[model samples]
Target: MVTLPIEFRTPLTEGDVGALGVLERDGIRFEIDSGRLILIAPRTLWHADACHRVANLRPYAYGRQGMRISRTTVRCPDVMVLFAEPDPDASCHDPADVAIVVEVVSPDTAVEDRVVKPRIYAGAGIPEYWIVDRHPTDPRDASVEHFKLGVSGAYQRIGQAALSELEKTG
Candidate 1:
């Protein structure tokens, strides 16, 4: 049987640094947070699709796999969309430029996505975030939980919506 390569991290930078130059290097997937590097592995289809939909946005889509942002480097849902005109000086690491962020949940990542990520995204003022639940017993239906940043610095659940709704909105 073929085995997948295990995901791992290599030290690159220090502190809450923002730019990570090692991602383009050979063999590792890196997410650059402020200054630290979190190594990740390539994502699955469900995760990539979630990011793609956000990128093929009406105005213009830019989907970046395993890009770093703020102090947390997220995999898969790392894609961001810009609905308006593009900024010449726009950087993927910039928190304000992101229209939406998506995260796919697995048993290992559920806690981080549910508890930690929201705080990070909210703190960055990321506007919108979608959490895709891929649990086995939760029905094969592709349901996504949406969240919008509230004034209180917490992600307010926009409730769960079918993938169809996302298609329509897009």
Candidate 2:
């Protein structure tokens, strides 16, 4: 098991989160409430494979691999779908430019992926968020929970389907 501990202790504003370097594990999930940096999770083979698959699906043009989708938001999701062409050299993106953010779940990141990330994405006005469900034991079958942000500023579960289904449809 590989562990990369982040040593950042400075109190940072929301926009400052973009300055943190992206790491192997999506890196850090900054605590906006308490202003603390927490290591996201260790990178696993399953997680890495799922990330590529989700990011490269149907709409390949808008996909971004390892970059922050929101300069004002804290957490960096696994993959992001930008409405506009992604700036190749840009480290952090504007929330208005991002349409969908995808997080591929693993054993270590399941809790954060389901709860914390959705909250951060919704608050940032991200139009959509997807949780690519992966189990620790059996990495073969991955399902997705598709969410769309509502007028009330919360993500509503719009659909659920297997990863294979999305690949097939796309």
Candidate 3:
């Protein structure tokens, strides 16, 4: 079995969060929520279209930003939008501050995105989560899966569409 680097498990402090916020890449400093840091990767045309749609929705959406939840610091997703009330008693991060969470599925990280991340989001009480799968025809495409947390502690599929469809709607 191959071992992935254990970098995601690093603990972070408020001071570290400040330092990370100033670390720039290609002229854009990343935003650190707790410990997980996010950087916006180069987007495909389809991605741009989807982003445009998401932007018009007036959800206070953010792309590539970290969200601090509980003890584990989750990496900022490809896109996250806030549509609800802000939590007053939030310590790690405000659950109510998050509305929709989207992830563009990559081959290396798809499983974690689908399996692991949803569980965390549900535990944090995030309401909506979207998983954008780039590969529709590939046999390995697990990308079509979209998961939303029910009142119970489980995820349910909401919608599944191609990248082109997502862009067109946006």
Clashing residue pairs in candidate 1 (N, C-alpha, C atoms within 3 angstroms): 16-34, 16-35, 17-34, 17-35, 18-34
lDDT of 3 by residue, 18-83 (tens): 345434333453434345555444666665555555545445676655576654354566677777
* Per-residue lDDT over 68-148 for candidate 2, one digit per residue giving the tens place of the 0 to 100 score: 433323545678887877667774566777788898877777888899878877987888999997643455867889999
Worst 10 residues of 2 by lDDT: 63-72
C-alpha root-mean-square deviation, each candidate: 5.9, 4.7, 7.3
Candidate 1 C-alpha error for residue 98, in Å: 1.7
Q: Which parts of model 1 have CA positions greater than 4 angstroms off?
A: 1-22, 25-27, 65-77, 87-91, 135-141
lDDT of all predictions, in order shown?
Answer: 0.60, 0.67, 0.59
Global CA lDDT computed for model 3: 0.59
User: Considering TM-score, which of the candidate structures 1 and 3 is the better prediction for this target?
Assistant: 1
TM-score of each: 0.68, 0.75, 0.64
Let me know the TM-score candidate 2 reaches against the reference structure.
0.75
Return the lDDT, model 2, position 56: 73
Worst 10 residues of 3 by lDDT: 1-10
- Model 1 agreement with the true structure over 32-126: per-residue lDDT tens digits: 45434456667777666655654554454565533245334543345555546666554444566667777767656779788887877787778
**Local error of candidate 3 at 101, Å?**
0.6
